[model samples]
Target chain A: MIISIVGAGALGKTYGGLLAQQHEVHYLMRSEYAQVKREGGFTLVFPPPQNSMQIEAPLLHQDAKTLPPSDLVIISTKTTANHELGALLGHCIKENTLVLVIQNGIGNEEWISQLVPHNPLICGVSSMKATRLENNTVEIAYIAELRLAPFQAATEKQCEIIEQAFAATSPAIPVKAYQSYKEIRWRKLIWNVPFSALSIIYQQDTQVLATRQPYVSIVRALMNEVADIAKADGVTISQEHMAKMLEATQKSGPYYPSMYFDSIQGKPIEKEYIIDNVLALARQYHIETPMLNLIQTNLN
Target chain B: MIISIVGAGALGKTYGGLLAQQHEVHYLMRSEYAQVKREGGFTLVFPPPQNSMQIEAPLLHQDAKTLPPSDLVIISTKTTANHELGALLGHCIKENTLVLVIQNGIGNEEWISQLVPHNPLICGVSSMKATRLENNTVEIAYIAELRLAPFQAATEKQCEIIEQAFAATSPAIPVKAYQSYKEIRWRKLIWNVPFSALSIIYQQDTQVLATRQPYVSIVRALMNEVADIAKADGVTISQEHMAKMLEATQKSGPYYPSMYFDSIQGKPIEKEYIIDNVLALARQYHIETPMLNLIQTNLN
Candidate 1:
C-alpha cells in the first residue's frame, strides 16, 4: 500500500506514521523540503515515545509529481492550505486511488470533492489532540478511536476497504472507524465553531471562554449557528445534547485550539474554512446567524 | 483654614496640593508615617502647571488623630480600599468638617453618608488621569475641569464656599451645583461601568475595546445596562446619545481607567462599585440588566 500525506503538520505526520507502518508513506512538508528525504525519512514523535512522541521516519517526498500512487492519498493539510494542496494532489493522483481528508473545520470535503469526484472520499472526525514539537516531532496529545464515513451517502464496498486499510495499521499504530461518522462530524463541527471562534476573539482557551460570559455567549451563539447549518443540511443536534458538549469543554482544562496556536505563530489563519464556509452555507440555507455574522466580520 | 486629607493616593494628592495654596493642609497617608514629617514638606511636581492649575505640598501627617477641625477634607482613595478608610474617618472626624469625596463610581455619597451623618460633605467628580512615576512623580493625564455638588440637596452657602476655596488655589477647578447630585453622579457612572469592565475583561485599553466586535458588543451591552439604570433612576438617555458616548470611548483612547490600573496591580477591583451598583439599583428599580450581571460575576 502507498499512502501520500498532503500535509506535514502534527496530524498529518501522526496519521501518516500510523499508516506508514504497513504502507509506503510520503509527506508534503512546507519547510526543509529537501532535508526530509536527505535524512532518509521524516520523524514523528508519537505518544508512546519517551519524553517525546517521535514517530517513524517514513519515506518522505515534498513534490506530488515524484510520488507513487496506490491505496490512498490523504489530505491532512490545515484548512487554510487545503485547496492549494488539493490542486497539488490532483495532478498526481490516479483514477482508482481513494481520498481521505482529516483536517479541522468544514469545506475540506468540498475542496477535495472537486478533485476526487467519482472516487471514494472519506470524511474523518478526529478527536485526537496533537501538536508539533519543532519540525518533525509531532506530539500526539491524546488518542481517540476516529469515526470515518463516506463524504457522500454512498456506503460502497470501497468505503469498507478504506476502513479495513485503517484497521490494518492498528497493529503498528492505532486506528478505528465508525458507521455513524456523519453524526460524529456534525457534533465535532459544533465544538469547532465555538472553540475556534471564541479562542480567536478572546485570545484565550476554552476554560477562559467558559468562565467569561461574553465569550461564552459568543461561543454558544456560533455553535448554534453550526448546529443550525447541520440541521438544515439534514443532521439533527438537540439543545440538551449541545449543553452537554459545552459542559465537556471544561474538561479540556486549558487547551488552546489549533487555530489559536496558528495565531500565536503569526501564521495565516483558516478563517475562510472555519468561519467563511459556515456563513456561506447559512446564507444558502437562509439560516438566521447574526452571531456567526459578527464572528465572520471579526475574522475578516 | 486647615484642610485634612484622607486616602492619599493620586486624586487625593492632586486635590490636596490644589487646596493647600490658600489653607494649611494636613494629609493623612498610610505607610511611611514618619517620612511624611521628615521630608520637611511633601513635594508635588506639576509639570507645565499653568492656566490656573496649582500644586502645593503642606504639613503632612500620617495618622488622622493629628488633625483638628479643618475647613475641608477630601477622600481620594481607591474604591476597593474605601471600606477600611471610611471606618477610620468615621472614628476621628469633627462634625463641623466638610469631607468631600472626590472619587469615581456610584454609592460613594451613600457609603460616606453612613460613616458621618449630618456632616457637611461635598461630592465631586474629577476627570484627571494620574500616573505615579517611580513612586515620586505623579503626572496629571487630564483635567476636564472638576465638578462639585452638595452631598445632599442643600441651598446653604456652604457648597459655594467649598467650591470657592478649591478655586482660590487651583482657580480653574469648576464646581457646578446640581439640583440633584445623583444625576451628575449617574452621568459620571456612565463613563466607568463600560470602560473599566471591558478593559479589565479583555486586558486592553479603550481603543482596543472600541475596535473589536466581541469587545464592542460587551461594551455596548454594558452601556445599555448603565443607561437603563440611569433611566430607571429618573435620567433620560436616548439611544443615539448613548451611542455617541461609546464613540467617545475611542476618542478617550489609550487612557487606562482606575479599575483597569487596579487590576494590573492585582489589587481588589471596584467591580462591586461600578457594575454591581448599576445591577443592584436595576434590581431595586426592576430594570433588567443581564449584561451587567455577567460582567459583575466575571469580575468577582
Candidate 2:
C-alpha cells in the first residue's frame, strides 16, 4: 500500500519509518527536510535491547503538491501547524484515501474532514512515545497500541486494513480499533490534559505527576474535570477508566509529554487543540471545569 | 531607636540601610553574613538618576543571641524560613519590642504574634521592590508606600512611630497605617495572590500578566477569588481596589514579585504564607476559589 506521512517530526518519523519497511511510505518534511534528504534517510532508535535500524533512502517529499495521492496519509504534525493542513493535504487526499490524524488533543479529525469532505477520516490516539533526537534520528521511548476510531466516511473495514499494514512491519506497531471517535479522544484526553499540562506547569515528568502528593491529587482533579466535560459532551468516562489512565502513566516510567518538549524547545504548544477545545466543549455543555479552566489560563 | 532587621535579603538590606542612616540599625544575616561583614557593609543602589549610597560599616550580627534586645525587630525573610523565627528572633525580641513582619503573604504576622505574644506585632505590606545583587549589594527598583497594620498588642501610636522613622530617612520609604490587619492583608493579596502566583506559574512578570489577553482575564479571576475569600473571611474588598491593584501593577513597568524571584533562584517560594494560608481561609469560610486552588496546585 502507498502511504504518505505529513509533518515528519518524532512521531511521524517513527511510524513512517516502520511503515516504510514494508510499504511504500513517503515522508512529507518541513524543517528536517534538507537534513533528512542530505543524510539519505533516517534512523529509528528503539528502547531497551532492541537494535536501532536505518531506514535507508525512503521516499521523501518536501512539498505535498509534488507527492502523489496514496491509500493512506498519516497527519502527525504538532497540532500548532494544523492550519497548514488544507494546502498540505489538498493534493494528496483522494475520495477513498484514509486520512489518519495521529496527533494529541481533539478537533483535528473534524478539521481534516472539513477540508477533505469526501475522504475517509480516521482519528488516532497513540500511546507510542517517540522523540526526534537530531534531524534524521528518531528515538522511540515507549511502544503502546495506537487506538483508532473512524471519523467521517471511514469504515471499520478501513481501520482494519490500516491495522493489518502496521502489523506487517518488521516490529509490528500495535493497533486497537474503537467504535466511538468521541470516546477514544476523551479517553486519550484523560491522560493528555492533566499530565501534559501539569508537566509543563510543574516542570516535572509523568511519573512525578502520577506519584507525587499534591500533583497526584491535581492529576486526579484534572482527570475528573475532563471526565465530567466528556460526559456532558455525550461520553461517559468512568472512575475505573480514570484510575487505569493514572495507573498506566505511573508505570510508564519517567516520560515527558510532547507538550512539555514543545514548551522547553520554545516551540508553540498544542494548547488550542488539547486545552482550548476541551474548554469550548465544557462551555458548550455548561460543564463547570475549574481545574480545566485553570489549566487553560496557565497555558494562555 | 535600636532596630534589628532579620533575614538581611534585598528588602532587609534596603530598609535596614535606610533606617541605619538615622537609627542604630543592626542586620542579622545568614548566607550573606560573612561576605557582608567582610565588605564592611552593603551598598544600596537606587533606580537610575539617584546616586548609589554606601551604607558603610553598619552593625551586623550573625547570631541573634549575641545581639542586644532590639527596640524594633523587622522580619523580612522568605516565609519558608518562618519556622526558624522562634530561634532567630528569640533573643532580640523584647517584651516591648515592636516585631514588624515586612514580607509577602498573609500568615507571617500571625505566626510572629504567636511566637512573641507580648511584643507589639505589625503587619507590613510593601510596594517597594528591590533585588540583592550580591551578599553586600542591594538595588532598589521601585520605592512605594509600606502599608502597616497592627497585628497583636500594636497601638496606633506605635505604627506612627514606625511611620515617622521611615519618613526621617534621606530616601523616605512611604508608610500607610491601617486599622484592620485582615483588611490590609486581603487588600495586598488582591495584588499579591494573582501577580505573585501567576508570575511563577506563567513565568512572566507583572506587566505581562496585567497587560496580556487571557492573562489579564486570569488576573481578574484570581483577584475576584481572593476578594470572595476575603469577603467570606469578613473583609470586604471593593472592585475599585482590585482595579487599582491591577493598574498599579501595569504602571509599575516590568517587575518580578518576590515569589517569582524566589522561584527562579531555586529558593523555596512563599507558598505556605501566600497561597496555602489563603486556601486554608477559603476552606474555613467554605469559599470556592478555583483560581487560587489552581495556583496552590501549581505551586505544589
Candidate 3:
C-alpha cells in the first residue's frame, strides 16, 4: 500500500520511518522545504538501528501540494497541529483514505471528522515513548499496545490492509482494531487526563510525581471520577483497568509526558483539551466533580 | 514567686532571664555537677547590654536526681523529645508543682498526662518561633497567641498567679486560657498534618509546596477530613477557620517545618502522632478519610 504519513516530525517521522522500511512511505514535511528537498530525508533511528533510524532521503515532499493521494494517511502530529494536518489530509486524500490519528490529547478524531467529513476517521492512542532528537532522530524508548478505535464501518479487507501497512512498517508495535472505539478511547483518556494534565500543573518529573501522596491520591480520585463519567456515558471501564492505568504511569515515570514538555516550552497548555473534556462530560452527566474540577482550574 | 524554668532553650531562657530582673528566676540546667558551675547567676542579655543576653547559671542539675523540688517546673523541651521530658517531669515534680507544656503536636494533654499522671498538667500551644543564639541569647521570630488549656479547672487566683508569672517574664507574649483544650490542640493538629508532613514527604520548598495543585489539594483534603472528624467528635471547626489554617501555612513558605527537620535527621516522623490521632478519631467516627489514611500509611 502507498502510505503518505502527514505532519512528519517526531511522531510523524516515527510512524513514517518504521513503516517506510517495509512499505512505500511518503513523509509530508512542513516549511523547512529546501532542507528536506535536498538529501537526508526523515532521519529515523530505529531499533537495532532503532537507536536512530536515518532514512537516507526516502521519496520526500515538502507539502501535501507536492504529494500524490494514497490509500492510507496516518496523521501523526500534535493534537494542536491536528487541524492543519486534517486540512492537508482533505486536500491530498483519495476517495476512501483511512485517516488513522495516532496522537495524544482528546478530540482529534472529531477534529478531523469535522474538516474532512467524508474521510474515515480512526483515533488510535499510541503508548510509545518517542522523543525527537532534532529533525534527524527520534528515540522510541518504550512501546505499548497501539489501538485503532473503530470510526466508521469499513470493510474487513480494508481493515486488514490498513493493519498490514502499519504492521509491515513497525511489526513490533501492535495495532488492535476496536469494535467499540469510545470505550478504548475513553479508557485511554482516563489514563492521559490525570497523568498528563497533573504533571503540567505540578511542573515536576513523573518519578517524583508518583511519590507525592497528594498527587497520587488526586490521580486516583480523578481516575475514579473519569470512570464514573465513563459509566454514565455508557462506557464500560473497570476499576482494575483504572489501577493498571496508574501502574503504567508509574512505570513510565523516568519519561516525561508531553503535557509536561508543553509546559516547560511555555507553549499553549492542553488544560482545556485534556481536563476540560472530562469536566464538560461530567457537567453533561450532572456528576459532582470537585476533584477533577479543581485540578482543571489549577492547570496552566 | 520562686520560679524554676526547665529546658533552658530560647523561649525558656527568654522568659527565665526576663523574670530574673524582677522576680526569682532559676535557670535549671540538667548537669552542672562536673564543672562549669558558677554562682554568677543567669545573665539575661538585654537592650541594655549590647543586645545579647548572657544569663549566669542559676541552678544546674541532671534530671530528678539533683536539686530541691520547686513550687513550679516550667517544661520547655522539644516535642520530639517529649517522651524523655515527660519522664523527667515525673521524676522531679514537687507535691504542688504545676507543669505547663510549651510545645506543639496533638495529644499533649494525654501524652504528658500519661507520664506525669497525677500532676497538675497545663496543655499549652505556642505560636512563638524562637531561635536560640550563642550563650543565653534568643530571638523571637513571630508573636502569635499562646493557649493554655485548663489542667483541672484551677481557681481564679491560681490562674491569676500563673498569668502573673508569664507576664513578669515575657510582656510581649499573650497567653489565653482555654476552657476546652482538646479543641485548641485539634486546631493546631490540622495545620501540621498537611503542610509539615507534606514538606517532609515532598522535600519541596515552601513556595512550590504552597501553591502546587496536588500539594494544596492534599493539604485541603487532609484539613477537610480532619474537619469532618472534628465535627463528628463535636468540635466546632468552621470552614472559615479551616481557610485560615491553610492560609497561615501557605503564607509561611520557604520555611523548613520542624517535621522536615525531624525527617532529615532520621528521627521518628511525627505524622504517626499528629495525623495518626486524626485517623484514629476518624476510624472511631467511621469517617471516610482517604487523605489522612494515605499519608499515614506512606511514611510509616
lDDT of 3 by residue, A166-285 (tens): 666543566777776677678777877777866776565666556566567777878878888888887978888877766766776565678888788887666655777677878899
Docking class of 3: incorrect
**C-alpha DockQ of every model:** 0.03, 0.08, 0.02
RMSD, one per candidate, in order = 14.2, 14.4, 15.3
Per-residue lDDT tens digits of candidate 2, residues A1-300? 788898888888888888887788888998888898888988999987788989898788888897788889999888999998889998777768888999889888878788889888999998887877855678887688999999998899999998998898868889999999998899889889998998888788899889876578778878888898899878898999788878977887998888998899899999998999998988898876656766776776
For candidate 1 chain A, the 10 contiguous residues with the lowest summed lDDT are A47-56
Which regions of candidate 2 deviate over 4 angstroms? Answer: B1-300
In CAPRI terms, where does candidate 2 land?
Answer: incorrect
| Better by lDDT, candidate 3 or 2 | 2
* Candidate 3, lDDT over the whole model: 0.67
Candidate 1 per-residue lDDT, tens place, A106-203, comes to 76677777776766778877778877665545566667666667775236465666667667764333445555555666778798877886687667
Name the runs in model 1 displaced over 4 angstroms: A1-300, B32-38, B45-57, B153-156
Q: How many backbone clashes does candidate 1 have?
A: 7
Per-candidate TM-scores read 0.55, 0.57, 0.54
Q: Which residue pairs collide in model 1, if any?
A: A44-A54, A44-A55, A45-A53, A45-A54, A45-A55, A46-A53, A46-A54
